[model samples]
Target chain A: MAPQDDNVDAVEEAMVAEVEKKPIATIVIIIAMQTEALPLVNKFQLIEDHDSVFPKGVPWVRYHGTYKDLFINIIWPGKDAVLGVDSVGTVSASLVTYASIQALQPDLIINAGTAGGFKAKGANIGDVVMVSDVAFHDRRIPIPVFDQYGIGARRTFSTPKLVKELDLKVGKLSTGDSLDMSPQDEAAINANDATVKDMEGAAVAYVADLLSVPAIFIKAVTDIVDGDKPTAEEFLQNLVAVTAALDQAVTKAVDFISGKCLSEL
Target chain B: MAPQDDNVDAVEEAMVAEVEKKPIATIVIIIAMQTEALPLVNKFQLIEDHDSVFPKGVPWVRYHGTYKDLFINIIWPGKDAVLGVDSVGTVSASLVTYASIQALQPDLIINAGTAGGFKAKGANIGDVVMVSDVAFHDRRIPIPVFDQYGIGARRTFSTPKLVKELDLKVGKLSTGDSLDMSPQDEAAINANDATVKDMEGAAVAYVADLLSVPAIFIKAVTDIVDGDKPTAEEFLQNLVAVTAALDQAVTKAVDFISGKCLSEL
Candidate 1:
C-alpha cells in the first residue's frame, strides 16, 4: 500500500479513454464518499487520472479520473443529502452521469463512504460494514406485508445476489437523508438494525437496483450513532480513523471490480 | 356508445389535467385516430391529447391528465429512438409533473396507446391483446440463461400484476424507438418470447415499480415488427382489421382501471 504519490499524479495524467469501445463491462463499481474516499484502500495505486473524464466544481459539472484498473470518475453534485446530476424525465440521472463518462460502462456501482454506526452490541467503532439491504427507513406505506421505511414485515430493503457473492457482513442501512437529527433518531435507527449510517449509499443503491447492476456499498463506522447525542462535528472529527479503513476497503474493492470485469470476459 | 358531441373541434382545448376525485368507472376504448377517440363512446373520453398538451412542441416529454376517479395522460417521445430524455427518467418526471396537476393522487396509472405486434403464427391483423409483459428488447446482453436487458438477467422485463388479475389476453410489448420492422428481426423478438412491441410501456412500468405504485399499460396492436427491411408506415398499413379491436381494447382498459381503483377503496 502506497501513499498518494507525486508521480502518481503523472500516472493519472497519462490515462486516456477511447470512445471506440466505451468500457461497458458486465461489472462496475460506484464509490460514494461522505468525506474523502481515498484512505479506505490500504494499497492506494494510481491507475489513470484524466483532465476531464468526470466533473469538477460548482460551475464545472464533470470530472474524469480513474484509479487502479477501475475507470473511476467523480461527480460531486454538491447537494447536501443526495447528490447526483439532476436529469430530466424519469431516468437514472446518476447512472446516466456515470454512463456519460465513457471510459468504462460499468455493470456494477459501489457506494463507499463513512457512516454513523448504531453502536449496538453487534457493531463497534472502525468496523467496515456492508449494507446488506438499503431502504428509506422513514418511508411508511402499509401494503399487504406492512412494510415501512427499511423495516418491513415482508422485506424492507433491496438485497441482490451480488451481496451474497461478495461474502460481506450485512447490516441494515437508512435510505433517506437526515433532515432533522432529533433525540428520537436512535429509536428509529435502532429499528432498522444497521451497522452504520450515511446519506448517499441508499440513493446509489436505489439506482443500481433499477439498472439491475451489482452494487457494493461499503461504510466504515465513524461515530457511534447512539453514544451520547450525535452531531455533525462529532462525525467529522472521526474522519481519519474511518479513512484508514477506507484505504484497505478500497484496495479490496479495486481488486473485486477487476475480478468482476475479468470474469465477464 | 355515443360520441362526446362529435362534429365539434377534434383537437383538445387544454393540456393541464382536470381533477377526478371519485369519478364514475368506465370502460377503456382505443379510437385509432385522434378524431375518433372521444366520439366512439359517450362514455369514452380522451385523457390527454398531445397536440393540445404540448402545443409548443415539447419533444421527448409526456403529459398526464386525470379526470375524477379516472386518470389519463398523453405520451409521444418524438416517434423514434436516439432520445433527448432517457425513458425511465422522463416517466418519473411525467408522473411527478402530472401528479401535481391531477391534485387527486391516482391509485394506478393506466397507459392507453397503440403498439406493433411481433409476428407470430397466432397473432394476426388488429388483434386486441393486453400486454402480459413489457420489456426493452433492444437493451440486452447475451447471458447464460438467455439474453437479458436489466432486471435480473440480460433479458429483463416488467409484468403488471393487474394484467394477470384481469385475465387480459397476454401480449408482449418491446420498448425503444428502433422498431424492428424487418423480416430479419423475427429471430431476436422470438428470443424474448414477446408478441407485441412499443416504445414507452417498459419505461412507465419501471417508474411504477420504483414509486411502489401499481400501473397497467394497455397497448393496441397497430403494426407488426418483421424487421428493418420494411418501413414503419408500410407495416402499420398492413393491419386493417385492428381498427375496431383497438377501440374495444381501449374501452376495456379504462373499465379495468376504474374497477381496480374502486375495488381498492
Candidate 2:
C-alpha cells in the first residue's frame, strides 16, 4: 500500500509538470495610443513590422518579437496618418483587435492602456488595475430591453491566478467614446459598478468575445473621474506617470504568463 | 474596313451585354435594430438563418434570399438575448458588419436605418437621403492634430449615377452612440456638414472601407434634432412611420441595383 501510494504521487506530479509546461505561445497586446504602446514595445524590444503587415493604406502599426518563450505583438490602431490623432475609441479598438486576431492568430489577447479611475472605488493616480469586467457607459439605448443592451456588459477573461500572483488591484471597467462623462454616462457607469473607465476596453472585450478569444484588460489610472480638477487637465498631467506604472505591471504580467497556460493564469 | 468595323461593333455589343448581365451577386444590408430590419427582410422575403450563419451565441441575426438578379442578406445587430435590447451603436454595428463581410463576402453593402435629421440642414421627417459621406460626431478628442482623427470622416461609395437616376436627396451622415446630442457633438456634426445623424452609419462605413467593400447609406429621417420635442419622444413617435419610408426607399434602391455593376451605381 505504501509503495502504491508513492507511485501515485509521482504520476500526479509528472502530470502537473506537463500541464505547467504547456505555454501560451502567442499573445497580442492591443493598445490604442502610440504613447501607451511605445513603452511596452520598447520594453519587449519588439521591431516595427515595416513591410506593412496590416492593410496597406491603413495606419495600423504592428510591432513584434519573441520575449522569453512567448511570441508577442503590440498593435496600435495607429495615428490617423492625415489627422495625427491616436485612434482612441471603441470603433478603432474593435477593428484593430479583429484585424490582429485574423492575422496573428494569437492564443491570448491583452488590452493594455490608460484609463480614468473613480476615487470612490479606491483608485489612485498611478494604480494598475486588472479589469474583472467591462461595460459601455455612453450607449444609452432607452428602449425597454435595450437599456441593458446599451450597457453592453461583458465579462473579461477570468485571471484570478494572475491577479492574485501579481498582487494587482481588480475592478470593473466602463468604456465610452468621450473623455468627459455626462450625467447619463455617470448613471450608466454607476449601473455598471465600474471603478475605472476608458475609451476602448469594452470594445476590445466585445471583439474578443465575438471571436471566442481569451482577453484580459490591464489599465493604469491616469485621472480621477470624481476628482475636482477638469478631466482633460488631470488626464494630460498624469498620463506619463501612469504609462510608466502600466509598463511595469504589464511586464510583470507577461513574465508571470511566460511558461504557463491560460488555465493557470 | 466597313465589314471589319461592323464585326468589331458586334463583338463590343456582346461584351457590353455580358458585363451588364454579370450581376452584383451578393449584397449585405446592415441595420442596427430589428424594427429597421423587419421591413426590408419582409419586403425581400428573406429567410431567417436559424442555424446561425453568424457565430453561435452572438445576438447578430441574418436573413438572406434572392431579389431579382441580386442575392441579398439583411443583418441586424439583434437584441441581447438576455436583456432583450437592440444592440444599436457603433461598437455593435462594427462587429456585426465585420462578421457579415467575413461570412457573406458581400459585393456591396447597404446601411439602411432611421436617423435624426436637422432642420438646420433642411431635413424633413420621412425623407430618405442618400448619405454622401459619414463621420463620427461624439468622438471628441481635442488634441492638436487629433481633432480631425476624432471626427473619423469617411466618404460613402460614389453613387452619383444612382442618385441622379433615383432622384434621391444626398447629404452627409454623422454617427454617435447616443441618440441625444451633446454640445460637443453639435460642433463636430457642424464640422462634418452632416444633415442626418444615426447610431450606426459611420461605423458600418468604417468596416466596409476597411474590407474594400463599396457601401451606400440610405437613412430615413425620424426626428428633427432642432425641433421643440425631446429626441426620445420624437424618435419613438416617428419610428414606425420612418420604417415604412425606409423600406420603400431601400426597395427602390434595390430594384435599381438589380442588374447593375458597382461601377455603374
Candidate 3:
C-alpha cells in the first residue's frame, strides 16, 4: 500500500478506539423539586459537588455521580411554573433543560417527578406512568395557526423494550402551568385523553427534541385530577406515597438504561 | 426659635424642594411582545438606548422616553410560555422586571398587552379591559400547604379614581403559560369570572407587588376565548385591530396617570 493509505488506516483505527474509550452512557435526570429527587439521590448515593457553580443568583440545586459505568446528573430547577412565585413558567424549564443538555451532552434525559392523574382514565394515586407522548392542554393558540407554530403536540418516545420489561403503563401526559383545575378544565382534560398532568414535562420534552436527544418521563401519580378535594390538599396528603412509587420507577429506568440500552449502544 | 432650629428648618425646606424637583412619576410598561409595545413606543417616540445593556443573554427588548411629566419605559419579554423556545418562563419575567425595577425604580407599572377574552363575560374583539385582580388557574399544588405558600389571588389595584375616570371595565384577569385552553378550561375560566386571559400578567404583577409598587393590567381583546376558530388564527387575523385598541387603551392609561393619578400623588 502507498504510504498515505497506511497513514489513513492508522488514523481511522485511532478514531474508533477513542470512541470506544468514552463513557458508555451519560444520563441527565432533571427533577423539578428536591423532594421528587431524593429517592434517586439516596438510591444512587450521588454526591453534591460544591465546586460546581450555577449562574449568579440562579436558585437551582444540582447533584452528580458515576454509577456502574454510567454518569448521572440530577438538577432541581429552582423556579416553579404554577405558583409564579420564583421562576418564569416554561421558560425556566426550557432554558435550564437546554443548558443542561448543552453542558452534559447526555445520551438520554429523564424527567422524573410527581403528577396528578385522571381518575376517569384509570389513573390512581401512587401509580407510576411512563410518558410516551406529551401535549400542552393549556396552550390554546387559536386554530389554523396553532399547527403552523408547531406547539400543538410535542411527542417523545420511550424505549419500548424497556417499557415492556418494566411492565410500565405507557400513556399520554398533558402539561400546563396551572395547579388547580376548574370543573370545565376537568372536562377538557378528559377530552384530551391524557392519563397524567404536570407543569414541566412538555417544556423539557421540547428542549430534548430540539437537541436531538431521547427523553423519557417517569411520573408518580400523586393526586386525582378531578378529586373532590382541592389539589393542594390531595398533593400534600399523597406526596409520600407517590414519591415512593417514583423511587422504584426511577431505579427501574436506570437499570434499564445500564443493563439494556447501554449494552445495545 | 434658636439659630440651630432655623438652620434645621432651612435644611428641611431644601430637602423637600429637592424631592419636589424630581420627576413627578415614573411608569414602567412591560408588554410581552414587540407587536404589543409598538404603538406605545411610537406614540411616546421612545428611543432605543443602545448603551444601556441588559444582563448578557436575556431575551428582552427595551425602550424608554419621557412623555409630559412622566418617564415611560417599555419592555418586550420575547416569546410565549408554551414553546419554551426562549428564556425561562416566569423566571425571565421576574428577573427582567426586577432588574428593570432596580434600574428605573418606576413609581408604577402597567402591564399592557392583548388577551383572549371570554365572550360570555361581555368581551368582544378590540375591546379594552382593565384588570383589578389576577390569579393563576394552572398552579395546582395539591397540598394542604398551598395556602401557606400564598400563590393564589394576587390582587393589584389601579388608581381607583383614575379607573373610574377612564371608563374601563374593572374585573379579574387570569394568567398562565399556555397560549391555548381546552373547552373545560374555557368553562372554568368563565366560571372564575375572569374578563381576560394572557401569559405574563401574573408574574409581572407578582414582581411589582413584591417590590411594593402598585400595578394595573390593561388588556385589549384580540380573540374570543371560546370562539369557534383556533386562537392562533384569530390572534393573527385580528392583530392589527387588537393592537389599535391596545394603543388607545395605553394612551388613555397614560392620560389618566399624568392628568389624574400623578396629581393625586
Candidate 4:
C-alpha cells in the first residue's frame, strides 16, 4: 500500500475507537412543560410510561427510549390535576429533577425550557442559549451571609467543545418563580449578570449538583423581559416558535453528547 | 364485685385501649433553619444522624428518635457549605421533605418554622400559627388560568382535633422565596387571603399532597411583613425568640399526634 493509504487507515481507526468507547449511556432531559417536551419525545420516538415509572397519583410524567447510543428519558412535571395548568416553578422542577435522578440515575441531566431574555443583552425571540451559570433572582433573604445563600448561584457543567462545535450563543441564566419580573427581581438579575431568565434552571442546577451529576441548561427565548411588549402576551405569542427552536438546539446537543465522555463536552 | 368497682375497672380498660392504639408510628418534622431545628432536636432528644440516612456530602441533617409512641425524625436542610447560611427556601424545603418521606416513610409530616405575620390579621409576636391553607405569594404567572396556577393554593391537612386540643391560632399561610415582600407578592398574598407568609409552607404542602402524606404547618411569628419595622432587621432580632415559640408548638403538636390516627387529626 502507498503511504497515503496508510495515513487514511490510521485516521479511520482513531474515529472508530472514539465511536466504540461509550462513556455516557443514560441521559435524563428534564423539561418543565409538556409543550417543551412533546417535540423531543416525538423526535426520539420515546414512549409515555404511565405504569408506576414515577410514583402513582403524582403529575410527573416520564417518557423513555433509546437514541443512538444514549438511553434517553424526558421527565415533565405534568399538569396540576385540579387546576389543569402546567406546574412551571422551581418547586416542581426541583422535586421532579431529584426524583428523576433517584429513579433513572442518569449519567447527565439536561434542563431544557423556554426563557425570557433581555433586549439589552442582544437576545431576540427564538434564540437558543446554552447557559453557563445560574442564580436565583427572587430568593432575597437580605440577612448578611444568608443573602448570598438565597441567590444560590451555581455553575452548569462546562461545555466548551459542544458550544464551539455547535456555534451556540452562551449566557448566564437567572431563575425565580415569577413569570413577570419585579423591580427587586430585575436588580437581582442584573447582579447575576444574566442575559436570560427562567423559573427552573437554577433549581435543577442545585439538585443536579447536590447529586453529583453534571447538568447543562438549554433555554430558548420566548419573550424579552425588559422590552416594550407585555411579557404575558409576548411569551404566549412566541412560545410555539421558540419551543421549536429549543427542540432543534436540544436535538443537536444530544447528538453531540451521544457516546461521548464528560471531558469531551 | 361491687357496682362502683366494676365501673372503675371499665374506665381503666378504656384508657388502656386508647394508649395501645399506635396509629401514627412515624412522624417527620421538616424545619428550614438550624435555629428553628436546634430547639426541637433538644426537646425531642433526637440523635443527629451523620451517616447514610441522607445522601453523602449533602448538607441535609436528620435527627431521629422515639418520642412517646411516635418515631420522630427532624430533618433540617443544613447550612450551605460554601455560604455557611441556612437553606431556607422552598427548594430546600421541598427536597428535604421528599427525601425524608422517601427514607423514613413517615405517617405524618410537620413543617415547623418561623414566619412573618400580619398585624391586621390579629397576629402578635411569638404567636404560633397552625396554617389551615397554604399558597404561593410570588409565583406570579399573569396568564388567564395560569394566574391561578401560579398561586398554587392547597388546603393543609385538617387538624380540627389538634387545633381544638392545643388551642393553636389558625391562619392562612402564603409562601415566597423572598424574606421581604414585593408589591406583586403582597397582591398575591391578599388574593390568597393569607395572614402569615413564610418561605416554605406552601411548597411543603405541595410535596406532601403529591406523596399522599398528611402534613400540618406550625409556624411561629418572627416578623410582621406589613409592620413598620424593616423585614431583615426584624427577622434577625426575633429569630431566636420565635424559634423557641416554634419548638413549644411543635412539641405539643407531636404529643397530640403520637398515638392518633390521621382521621383523628
Candidate whose DockQ is highest: 4
Give one digit per residue, the lDDT tens place, for model 3 in B167-257.
8777788876557775544554665569898776777777676555667888889888777977767877897878987888788778767
Candidate 4 chain A weakest lDDT stretch, 10 residues? A13-22
Error of 4 at A18 (Å): 16
Worst 10 residues of 4 chain B by lDDT: B13-22
Task: State which docking tier applies to candidate 4.
Answer: acceptable
Give all candidates' CA lDDT scores. 0.44, 0.86, 0.70, 0.89
Residue B89 of model 2: what lDDT?
A: 88
TM-score of each: 0.40, 0.84, 0.62, 0.91
DockQ of each: 0.03, 0.29, 0.17, 0.35
How do the candidates rank by DockQ, highest first? 4, 2, 3, 1
User: What are the root-mean-square deviations of the candidates from the true structure over C-alphas?
Assistant: 20.6, 9.1, 10.2, 10.7
Top lDDT model = 4
Model 1 lDDT tens row, A66-86 = 454555543333221112222
Task: Score candidate 2 by lDDT.
Answer: 0.86
Better of 1 and 4 by TM-score: 4
TM-score of 2: 0.84
| Candidate 2 C-alpha lDDT tens digits along A1-265 | 1124888779977875664457799999999888889989989999999896666456789999999989999999886655567778998898889878878878899999999999999988899999999999887766666666677788998989999988999999999888888777788899899999999999998888877678999999999999998888898898888999999999999999998897789
By TM-score, who's the top model here? 4
lDDT of 3 by residue, A1-265 (tens): 1134888779977864564455447888888766777788889999875765454334555688988768888877654334434342354566567667756878778888889898878888988989888866655433444332333466775467777777888788887666776554555566567899887788788767755667889888988877686776788788887898898988877876773353242
Model 4: residues >4 Å from true position, as ranges? A1-22, B1-22
